[model samples]
Target: MKVEYKKASLGDIQVMQELVDPEVESGVILERSSDEMATNIRSYILAYVDGKLAGFCALHIHTASLAEIRSLIVDETHRGNKIGANLIYKCVDEAKTLGLQKLLSLTYRQSFFENLGFVEIQKESLPEHKIWADCIKCKHFPICNEVSLIKNL
Candidate 1:
Protein backbone atom coordinates (compact mmCIF):
# COMPACT_ATOMS: atom_id res chain seq x y z
CA MET A 1 0.00 0.00 0.00
CA LYS A 2 1.23 3.42 -0.95
CA VAL A 3 0.82 6.05 1.71
CA GLU A 4 1.21 9.80 1.39
CA TYR A 5 1.00 12.56 3.92
CA LYS A 6 0.18 16.18 3.28
CA LYS A 7 -1.25 19.30 4.83
CA ALA A 8 -5.05 19.41 4.74
CA SER A 9 -6.79 21.54 2.16
CA LEU A 10 -10.16 23.22 2.28
CA GLY A 11 -11.59 20.56 0.01
CA ASP A 12 -10.81 17.84 2.49
CA ILE A 13 -13.10 19.23 5.20
CA GLN A 14 -16.06 17.00 4.39
CA VAL A 15 -13.97 13.87 4.21
CA MET A 16 -12.27 14.86 7.41
CA GLN A 17 -15.64 15.17 9.11
CA GLU A 18 -16.65 11.80 7.70
CA LEU A 19 -13.45 10.16 8.95
CA VAL A 20 -13.97 11.55 12.43
CA ASP A 21 -17.70 10.78 12.79
CA PRO A 22 -17.40 7.28 14.23
CA GLU A 23 -14.80 8.41 16.71
CA VAL A 24 -17.06 11.27 17.69
CA GLU A 25 -19.96 8.90 18.22
CA SER A 26 -17.75 6.76 20.44
CA GLY A 27 -16.41 9.88 22.25
CA VAL A 28 -12.88 9.26 21.11
CA ILE A 29 -12.77 12.68 19.46
CA LEU A 30 -14.80 15.81 19.82
CA GLU A 31 -17.19 16.73 17.10
CA ARG A 32 -15.93 19.45 14.77
CA SER A 33 -17.98 21.62 12.48
CA SER A 34 -16.85 22.31 8.96
CA ASP A 35 -16.39 25.98 9.78
CA GLU A 36 -14.12 25.13 12.69
CA MET A 37 -12.14 22.72 10.59
CA ALA A 38 -11.84 25.27 7.82
CA THR A 39 -10.62 27.89 10.22
CA ASN A 40 -7.90 25.59 11.54
CA ILE A 41 -7.30 23.71 8.35
CA ARG A 42 -3.62 24.53 8.21
CA SER A 43 -2.97 22.68 11.44
CA TYR A 44 -4.31 19.44 10.04
CA ILE A 45 -2.29 16.66 8.48
CA LEU A 46 -3.97 14.18 6.19
CA ALA A 47 -2.87 10.68 5.33
CA TYR A 48 -3.81 9.02 2.08
CA VAL A 49 -3.49 5.34 1.36
CA ASP A 50 -3.64 4.27 -2.26
CA GLY A 51 -5.30 7.56 -3.21
CA LYS A 52 -7.91 7.51 -0.47
CA LEU A 53 -8.10 9.51 2.72
CA ALA A 54 -7.21 6.99 5.41
CA GLY A 55 -6.84 9.19 8.48
CA PHE A 56 -6.04 12.64 9.81
CA CYS A 57 -4.71 14.57 12.82
CA ALA A 58 -3.99 18.10 13.94
CA LEU A 59 -1.22 19.83 15.83
CA HIS A 60 -2.76 22.75 17.69
CA ILE A 61 -0.19 25.13 19.07
CA HIS A 62 -1.66 26.62 22.20
CA THR A 63 1.32 28.74 23.17
CA ALA A 64 4.96 29.17 22.28
CA SER A 65 5.99 26.36 24.60
CA LEU A 66 3.00 24.04 24.42
CA ALA A 67 1.01 22.31 21.73
CA GLU A 68 -1.63 19.64 21.77
CA ILE A 69 -2.14 16.74 19.41
CA ARG A 70 -5.83 16.77 18.56
CA SER A 71 -8.37 14.96 16.44
CA LEU A 72 -6.28 11.90 15.67
CA ILE A 73 -8.47 9.38 13.92
CA VAL A 74 -7.70 6.42 11.74
CA ASP A 75 -10.44 4.80 9.72
CA GLU A 76 -11.44 1.43 11.15
CA THR A 77 -10.42 -0.36 8.02
CA HIS A 78 -7.01 1.31 8.07
CA ARG A 79 -5.98 0.21 11.54
CA GLY A 80 -2.58 -1.47 12.08
CA ASN A 81 -0.87 0.42 9.28
CA LYS A 82 1.16 2.77 11.50
CA ILE A 83 -0.55 5.72 9.80
CA GLY A 84 -1.60 7.08 13.15
CA ALA A 85 1.96 6.96 14.45
CA ASN A 86 3.30 8.64 11.36
CA LEU A 87 0.70 11.40 11.63
CA ILE A 88 1.84 12.00 15.22
CA TYR A 89 5.49 12.00 14.16
CA LYS A 90 4.59 14.60 11.61
CA CYS A 91 2.98 16.70 14.32
CA VAL A 92 6.03 16.25 16.50
CA ASP A 93 8.27 17.35 13.64
CA GLU A 94 6.17 20.46 13.17
CA ALA A 95 6.15 21.24 16.87
CA LYS A 96 9.91 20.87 17.06
CA THR A 97 10.44 22.92 13.97
CA LEU A 98 8.38 25.67 15.53
CA GLY A 99 10.45 25.50 18.73
CA LEU A 100 7.67 24.20 20.93
CA GLN A 101 8.88 22.56 24.16
CA LYS A 102 6.03 20.21 24.91
CA LEU A 103 3.18 18.33 23.32
CA LEU A 104 0.03 17.37 25.18
CA SER A 105 -2.70 14.91 24.36
CA LEU A 106 -6.03 14.20 26.06
CA THR A 107 -7.06 10.74 25.07
CA TYR A 108 -8.67 7.53 26.23
CA ARG A 109 -5.98 5.51 24.48
CA GLN A 110 -3.26 5.86 27.09
CA SER A 111 -1.15 2.97 25.86
CA PHE A 112 -1.14 4.32 22.34
CA PHE A 113 0.20 7.73 23.32
CA GLU A 114 2.52 6.13 25.84
CA ASN A 115 3.97 3.98 23.08
CA LEU A 116 4.77 7.22 21.26
CA GLY A 117 6.70 8.52 24.31
CA PHE A 118 3.96 10.53 25.98
CA VAL A 119 3.87 10.23 29.76
CA GLU A 120 0.65 10.24 31.72
CA ILE A 121 0.04 13.48 33.62
CA GLN A 122 -2.58 15.21 35.66
CA LYS A 123 -4.87 17.48 33.69
CA GLU A 124 -4.40 20.15 36.32
CA SER A 125 -0.75 20.27 35.32
CA LEU A 126 -1.79 21.89 32.08
CA PRO A 127 -1.67 25.65 31.82
CA GLU A 128 -4.57 27.71 33.05
CA HIS A 129 -4.64 29.43 29.71
CA LYS A 130 -5.38 26.13 28.06
CA ILE A 131 -8.08 25.40 30.56
CA TRP A 132 -9.86 28.68 30.09
CA ALA A 133 -9.40 28.92 26.39
CA ASP A 134 -10.11 25.42 25.18
CA CYS A 135 -11.10 22.99 27.87
CA ILE A 136 -13.74 25.32 29.14
CA LYS A 137 -15.50 25.13 25.84
CA CYS A 138 -15.58 21.36 25.77
CA LYS A 139 -18.87 19.81 26.82
CA HIS A 140 -16.97 17.50 29.15
CA PHE A 141 -15.16 20.30 30.90
CA PRO A 142 -14.40 20.01 34.62
CA ILE A 143 -15.41 16.36 34.62
CA CYS A 144 -13.95 14.83 31.54
CA ASN A 145 -12.65 11.28 31.76
CA GLU A 146 -9.95 11.55 29.13
CA VAL A 147 -6.39 10.89 30.22
CA SER A 148 -3.79 13.60 29.93
CA LEU A 149 -0.33 12.84 28.55
CA ILE A 150 2.66 14.97 27.72
CA LYS A 151 5.84 14.59 25.72
CA ASN A 152 8.69 17.06 26.02
CA LEU A 153 9.94 17.80 22.57
Candidate 2:
Protein backbone atom coordinates (compact mmCIF):
# COMPACT_ATOMS: atom_id res chain seq x y z
CA MET A 1 0.00 0.00 0.00
CA LYS A 2 1.21 3.52 -0.78
CA VAL A 3 1.41 6.02 2.09
CA GLU A 4 1.28 9.77 1.68
CA TYR A 5 3.11 12.01 4.14
CA LYS A 6 2.55 15.69 4.76
CA LYS A 7 2.91 18.36 7.34
CA ALA A 8 0.06 18.41 9.82
CA SER A 9 -2.40 21.22 9.26
CA LEU A 10 -5.20 22.64 11.40
CA GLY A 11 -7.75 20.53 9.59
CA ASP A 12 -5.96 17.38 10.63
CA ILE A 13 -6.05 18.09 14.37
CA GLN A 14 -9.19 16.11 15.11
CA VAL A 15 -7.84 13.02 13.44
CA MET A 16 -4.47 13.47 15.07
CA GLN A 17 -6.18 13.83 18.42
CA GLU A 18 -8.10 10.62 17.92
CA LEU A 19 -4.89 8.86 16.99
CA VAL A 20 -2.92 10.22 19.93
CA ASP A 21 -5.30 10.25 22.90
CA PRO A 22 -5.15 6.53 23.50
CA GLU A 23 -1.37 6.53 23.84
CA VAL A 24 -1.49 9.45 26.23
CA GLU A 25 -4.19 7.78 28.29
CA SER A 26 -2.07 4.66 28.47
CA GLY A 27 1.00 6.78 29.38
CA VAL A 28 3.02 6.03 26.28
CA ILE A 29 3.18 9.75 25.65
CA LEU A 30 2.56 12.94 27.57
CA GLU A 31 -0.93 14.37 27.51
CA ARG A 32 -1.57 17.15 25.03
CA SER A 33 -4.66 19.21 24.44
CA SER A 34 -6.19 19.54 21.00
CA ASP A 35 -5.38 23.23 21.22
CA GLU A 36 -1.77 22.39 21.84
CA MET A 37 -1.66 20.19 18.76
CA ALA A 38 -3.29 22.91 16.72
CA THR A 39 -0.83 25.45 18.01
CA ASN A 40 2.17 23.28 17.30
CA ILE A 41 0.81 21.95 14.09
CA ARG A 42 3.90 23.09 12.23
CA SER A 43 6.03 20.72 14.27
CA TYR A 44 4.04 17.71 13.12
CA ILE A 45 4.11 15.37 10.12
CA LEU A 46 1.17 13.11 9.32
CA ALA A 47 0.94 9.87 7.40
CA TYR A 48 -2.08 8.93 5.32
CA VAL A 49 -3.06 5.73 3.60
CA ASP A 50 -5.92 5.54 1.12
CA GLY A 51 -6.90 9.04 2.26
CA LYS A 52 -7.10 7.99 5.92
CA LEU A 53 -4.92 9.47 8.63
CA ALA A 54 -2.51 6.70 9.52
CA GLY A 55 -0.12 8.29 12.00
CA PHE A 56 1.38 11.49 13.39
CA CYS A 57 4.88 12.52 14.47
CA ALA A 58 6.63 15.70 15.54
CA LEU A 59 10.20 16.80 15.08
CA HIS A 60 10.65 19.00 18.12
CA ILE A 61 13.83 21.06 18.06
CA HIS A 62 15.31 22.11 21.35
CA THR A 63 18.61 23.66 20.38
CA ALA A 64 21.01 24.26 17.50
CA SER A 65 22.33 20.72 17.52
CA LEU A 66 19.56 18.72 19.14
CA ALA A 67 16.06 17.69 18.23
CA GLU A 68 13.65 15.01 19.39
CA ILE A 69 11.10 12.92 17.53
CA ARG A 70 7.99 13.29 19.64
CA SER A 71 4.49 11.87 19.69
CA LEU A 72 5.06 9.28 16.94
CA ILE A 73 1.97 7.10 16.83
CA VAL A 74 0.74 4.80 14.08
CA ASP A 75 -2.83 3.55 14.12
CA GLU A 76 -3.27 -0.12 15.01
CA THR A 77 -4.77 -0.91 11.65
CA HIS A 78 -1.73 0.45 9.85
CA ARG A 79 1.17 -0.57 12.05
CA GLY A 80 2.83 -3.25 9.95
CA ASN A 81 2.76 -1.30 6.74
CA LYS A 82 5.92 0.71 7.62
CA ILE A 83 4.00 3.93 8.07
CA GLY A 84 5.85 4.63 11.31
CA ALA A 85 9.24 4.21 9.65
CA ASN A 86 8.26 6.54 6.85
CA LEU A 87 7.25 9.16 9.41
CA ILE A 88 10.65 8.86 11.05
CA TYR A 89 12.42 9.23 7.72
CA LYS A 90 10.48 12.43 7.09
CA CYS A 91 11.51 13.74 10.51
CA VAL A 92 15.11 12.83 9.80
CA ASP A 93 15.06 14.53 6.44
CA GLU A 94 13.54 17.62 8.01
CA ALA A 95 16.16 17.56 10.70
CA LYS A 96 18.90 17.39 8.07
CA THR A 97 17.33 20.23 6.16
CA LEU A 98 17.21 22.30 9.31
CA GLY A 99 20.93 21.61 9.96
CA LEU A 100 20.28 19.66 13.09
CA GLN A 101 23.14 17.44 14.24
CA LYS A 102 21.12 14.79 16.00
CA LEU A 103 17.69 13.34 16.63
CA LEU A 104 16.52 11.78 19.86
CA SER A 105 13.42 10.03 21.07
CA LEU A 106 12.23 8.75 24.41
CA THR A 107 10.30 5.67 23.51
CA TYR A 108 9.16 2.36 24.96
CA ARG A 109 9.43 0.70 21.55
CA GLN A 110 13.16 0.18 21.51
CA SER A 111 13.12 -2.40 18.75
CA PHE A 112 11.04 -0.18 16.50
CA PHE A 113 13.51 2.67 16.86
CA GLU A 114 16.48 0.35 16.78
CA ASN A 115 15.25 -0.94 13.44
CA LEU A 116 15.21 2.66 12.26
CA GLY A 117 18.92 3.05 13.19
CA PHE A 118 18.52 4.80 16.54
CA VAL A 119 20.95 3.72 19.25
CA GLU A 120 20.08 3.47 22.92
CA ILE A 121 21.61 6.21 25.02
CA GLN A 122 21.62 7.46 28.57
CA LYS A 123 18.70 9.83 29.06
CA GLU A 124 20.76 11.98 31.37
CA SER A 125 23.38 12.46 28.69
CA LEU A 126 21.02 14.78 26.89
CA PRO A 127 21.16 18.50 27.53
CA GLU A 128 19.33 19.87 30.54
CA HIS A 129 17.17 22.06 28.34
CA LYS A 130 15.45 19.07 26.74
CA ILE A 131 14.97 17.43 30.12
CA TRP A 132 13.60 20.61 31.66
CA ALA A 133 11.31 21.56 28.83
CA ASP A 134 9.49 18.25 28.36
CA CYS A 135 10.39 15.50 30.76
CA ILE A 136 9.99 17.64 33.85
CA LYS A 137 6.40 18.27 32.86
CA CYS A 138 5.73 14.62 32.20
CA LYS A 139 3.66 12.78 34.80
CA HIS A 140 6.11 9.87 34.86
CA PHE A 141 9.27 11.96 35.14
CA PRO A 142 11.27 10.28 37.83
CA ILE A 143 9.73 6.92 37.21
CA CYS A 144 9.78 7.02 33.41
CA ASN A 145 10.89 3.81 31.76
CA GLU A 146 11.18 5.08 28.22
CA VAL A 147 14.56 4.60 26.62
CA SER A 148 16.41 7.57 25.18
CA LEU A 149 17.52 6.72 21.66
CA ILE A 150 19.64 8.86 19.36
CA LYS A 151 20.79 9.01 15.76
CA ASN A 152 23.36 11.53 14.55
CA LEU A 153 22.07 13.26 11.51
Candidate 3:
Protein backbone atom coordinates (compact mmCIF):
# COMPACT_ATOMS: atom_id res chain seq x y z
CA MET A 1 0.00 0.00 0.00
CA LYS A 2 1.24 3.46 -0.84
CA VAL A 3 0.86 5.66 2.23
CA GLU A 4 0.84 9.41 1.72
CA TYR A 5 1.42 11.78 4.64
CA LYS A 6 -0.34 15.12 4.70
CA LYS A 7 -1.12 17.89 7.13
CA ALA A 8 -4.64 17.69 8.49
CA SER A 9 -7.09 20.54 8.03
CA LEU A 10 -10.31 21.36 9.84
CA GLY A 11 -12.33 19.30 7.36
CA ASP A 12 -10.48 16.21 8.48
CA ILE A 13 -11.97 16.49 11.96
CA GLN A 14 -14.59 13.75 11.49
CA VAL A 15 -12.00 11.37 10.08
CA MET A 16 -9.76 12.14 13.04
CA GLN A 17 -12.58 11.20 15.38
CA GLU A 18 -13.25 8.01 13.45
CA LEU A 19 -9.57 7.09 13.70
CA VAL A 20 -9.10 7.92 17.39
CA ASP A 21 -12.47 6.83 18.83
CA PRO A 22 -11.65 3.15 18.56
CA GLU A 23 -8.41 3.55 20.53
CA VAL A 24 -10.25 5.55 23.14
CA GLU A 25 -12.95 2.87 23.43
CA SER A 26 -10.23 0.26 23.83
CA GLY A 27 -8.67 2.34 26.62
CA VAL A 28 -5.43 2.61 24.71
CA ILE A 29 -5.60 6.34 24.12
CA LEU A 30 -7.25 9.42 25.54
CA GLU A 31 -10.54 10.48 23.96
CA ARG A 32 -10.52 13.58 21.80
CA SER A 33 -13.44 15.76 20.79
CA SER A 34 -13.89 16.83 17.20
CA ASP A 35 -13.80 20.41 18.38
CA GLU A 36 -10.42 19.85 19.95
CA MET A 37 -9.15 18.18 16.82
CA ALA A 38 -10.46 21.02 14.72
CA THR A 39 -8.78 23.60 16.91
CA ASN A 40 -5.45 21.80 16.72
CA ILE A 41 -5.82 20.50 13.19
CA ARG A 42 -2.58 21.98 11.96
CA SER A 43 -0.63 20.10 14.58
CA TYR A 44 -1.71 16.79 13.00
CA ILE A 45 -0.23 14.79 10.16
CA LEU A 46 -2.41 12.16 8.50
CA ALA A 47 -1.62 8.92 6.71
CA TYR A 48 -3.67 7.77 3.78
CA VAL A 49 -3.29 4.49 1.97
CA ASP A 50 -4.94 4.12 -1.43
CA GLY A 51 -6.75 7.36 -0.66
CA LYS A 52 -8.33 6.04 2.54
CA LEU A 53 -7.77 7.27 6.05
CA ALA A 54 -5.02 5.03 7.44
CA GLY A 55 -4.09 6.90 10.63
CA PHE A 56 -2.54 10.06 12.10
CA CYS A 57 -0.14 11.61 14.64
CA ALA A 58 0.53 15.07 15.98
CA LEU A 59 3.44 17.20 17.14
CA HIS A 60 2.79 19.60 20.00
CA ILE A 61 5.45 22.04 21.15
CA HIS A 62 5.70 22.65 24.88
CA THR A 63 8.91 24.67 24.88
CA ALA A 64 11.71 25.84 22.63
CA SER A 65 13.57 22.59 23.12
CA LEU A 66 10.75 20.14 23.64
CA ALA A 67 7.73 18.71 21.86
CA GLU A 68 5.40 15.76 22.34
CA ILE A 69 4.16 13.15 19.92
CA ARG A 70 0.40 13.00 20.33
CA SER A 71 -2.57 10.97 19.08
CA LEU A 72 -0.60 8.33 17.20
CA ILE A 73 -2.89 5.61 15.86
CA VAL A 74 -3.19 3.35 12.86
CA ASP A 75 -6.25 1.36 11.87
CA GLU A 76 -6.42 -2.08 13.49
CA THR A 77 -6.43 -3.60 10.05
CA HIS A 78 -3.35 -1.56 9.17
CA ARG A 79 -1.25 -2.82 12.06
CA GLY A 80 2.22 -4.11 11.06
CA ASN A 81 2.24 -1.87 8.01
CA LYS A 82 4.65 0.70 9.54
CA ILE A 83 2.13 3.53 9.29
CA GLY A 84 2.56 4.47 12.94
CA ALA A 85 6.32 4.54 12.64
CA ASN A 86 6.08 6.71 9.57
CA LEU A 87 3.77 9.11 11.37
CA ILE A 88 6.22 9.34 14.26
CA TYR A 89 9.10 10.00 11.92
CA LYS A 90 7.01 12.71 10.33
CA CYS A 91 6.68 14.33 13.77
CA VAL A 92 10.40 14.02 14.30
CA ASP A 93 10.99 15.68 10.97
CA GLU A 94 8.72 18.50 12.04
CA ALA A 95 10.43 18.76 15.38
CA LYS A 96 13.79 19.07 13.70
CA THR A 97 12.38 21.65 11.33
CA LEU A 98 11.21 23.73 14.30
CA GLY A 99 14.64 23.39 15.95
CA LEU A 100 13.38 21.27 18.82
CA GLN A 101 16.09 19.36 20.68
CA LYS A 102 13.92 16.64 22.15
CA LEU A 103 10.71 14.82 21.33
CA LEU A 104 8.79 13.07 24.09
CA SER A 105 6.18 10.38 23.87
CA LEU A 106 3.93 9.19 26.68
CA THR A 107 2.97 5.78 25.42
CA TYR A 108 2.02 2.32 26.61
CA ARG A 109 4.01 0.93 23.68
CA GLN A 110 7.49 1.51 25.06
CA SER A 111 9.32 -1.01 22.91
CA PHE A 112 7.82 0.54 19.84
CA PHE A 113 9.16 3.96 20.75
CA GLU A 114 12.42 2.46 21.96
CA ASN A 115 12.91 0.74 18.62
CA LEU A 116 12.57 4.12 17.02
CA GLY A 117 15.49 5.58 18.98
CA PHE A 118 13.64 6.84 22.05
CA VAL A 119 15.04 6.18 25.50
CA GLU A 120 12.98 5.54 28.61
CA ILE A 121 12.91 8.39 31.10
CA GLN A 122 11.09 9.45 34.23
CA LYS A 123 8.30 11.81 33.25
CA GLU A 124 9.51 14.25 35.90
CA SER A 125 12.74 14.71 33.98
CA LEU A 126 10.82 16.90 31.57
CA PRO A 127 11.26 20.52 32.56
CA GLU A 128 7.85 21.79 31.61
CA HIS A 129 5.11 21.60 34.22
CA LYS A 130 2.57 22.69 31.60
CA ILE A 131 2.91 19.36 29.85
CA TRP A 132 0.71 18.02 32.65
CA ALA A 133 -2.22 20.08 31.47
CA ASP A 134 -3.40 17.20 29.38
CA CYS A 135 -3.26 14.95 32.43
CA ILE A 136 -6.23 16.71 33.94
CA LYS A 137 -8.39 15.31 31.18
CA CYS A 138 -6.90 11.85 31.29
CA LYS A 139 -8.42 9.23 33.57
CA HIS A 140 -4.93 7.93 34.31
CA PHE A 141 -3.68 11.33 35.54
CA PRO A 142 -0.98 10.93 38.21
CA ILE A 143 -1.21 7.19 37.80
CA CYS A 144 -0.72 7.20 34.08
CA ASN A 145 0.04 3.77 32.71
CA GLU A 146 2.00 5.19 29.82
CA VAL A 147 5.77 5.16 29.80
CA SER A 148 7.67 8.34 29.03
CA LEU A 149 10.36 8.26 26.36
CA ILE A 150 12.51 10.87 24.68
CA LYS A 151 14.23 10.97 21.30
CA ASN A 152 16.91 13.55 20.85
CA LEU A 153 16.43 15.26 17.52
Which candidate number maximizes lDDT?
1
The sequence of per-residue lDDT tens digits that candidate 2 reaches over residues 119-145 is 999977988877787787687887889
Residue 2 accuracy (lDDT) in model 3 = 90
Q: Which regions of candidate 3 deviate over 4 angstroms? A: none
lDDT of 1 by residue, 1-153 (tens): 999999999999998998898888776688888999999999999999999999999999888899999999988889899999999999999999999999999998899999999999998898888778676666676788899999999
- Number of colliding residue pairs in model 2: 0
The TM-score of candidate 3 is 0.94
What's the C-alpha lDDT at position 135 in model 2? Answer: 84
RMSD of each: 1.3, 1.2, 1.3
Model 3: ten consecutive residues of lowest lDDT: 127-136
lDDT of each: 0.92, 0.90, 0.87
Off by over 4 Å in 1: 136-139
